[model samples]
Target: MSLPDFDTFRAAQAARGFDEVVARSWAPDEDVATHSHPFDADALVIAGEMWLTVDGVTRHLRPGDRFAIAAGTPHEERYGADGATYWVGRAEPG
Candidate 1:
């Protein structure tokens, strides 16, 4: 199946029982509020750089990098000077 465009990605998330799905190009200094999810997540960095805080520990993610996060984890994100574009997936199995 073909991948959905960024505009329609969130709909896919809803269809799959995901709390949220985000896909966008971020600018430097962009910040995502700290939050917790109830399911597993996979994030892929498409360009630039970012720092993700997971359970109080921060991990840097760069282009071509991917990360998986477990359920019920608290996390937040900060963009780097060059910013970043990423695809984030969050889902719970039925």
Candidate 2:
């Protein structure tokens, strides 16, 4: 199924009590250094690929893939050579 457009997600987020949505584009060789959050986070890949390292386990996620990162977990990410577009969901006011 086709994913909803950004506008649709933005509208939906606007109604939530605590929501933070990010439309992220990662360039080739880019890495989001390991970090931890106090709240839950989710990510949905739109294109290309990304490698998510959570608790020492690395998971490769490509287009149309979705995953959740538990709160307070240490995690990091890397983008493929072709880069990637992804949507992030956070439990925070955006």
| Per-residue lDDT of candidate 1, residues 22-66 (tens digit) | 776888989999887777877667778999998789989887677
lDDT of each: 0.78, 0.81
Q: Candidate 2's C-alpha lDDT? A: 0.81
The segments of candidate 1 whose C-alpha lies over 4 angstroms from its true place after superposition are 1-22
What is residue 24's positional error in candidate 2, in angstroms? 1.2
Off by over 4 Å in 2: 10-18, 92-94
lDDT of 1: 0.78
Each candidate structure's TM-score, on Cα atoms with residue i matched to residue i, is 0.65, 0.77
lDDT of 2 by residue, 1-94 (tens): 6877877766665565337888989889798998988877776788899899988899999878988877888999899999999887778424
Considering only N, C-alpha and C atoms within 3 Å, which residue pairs clash in candidate 2? none
Best by lDDT: 2
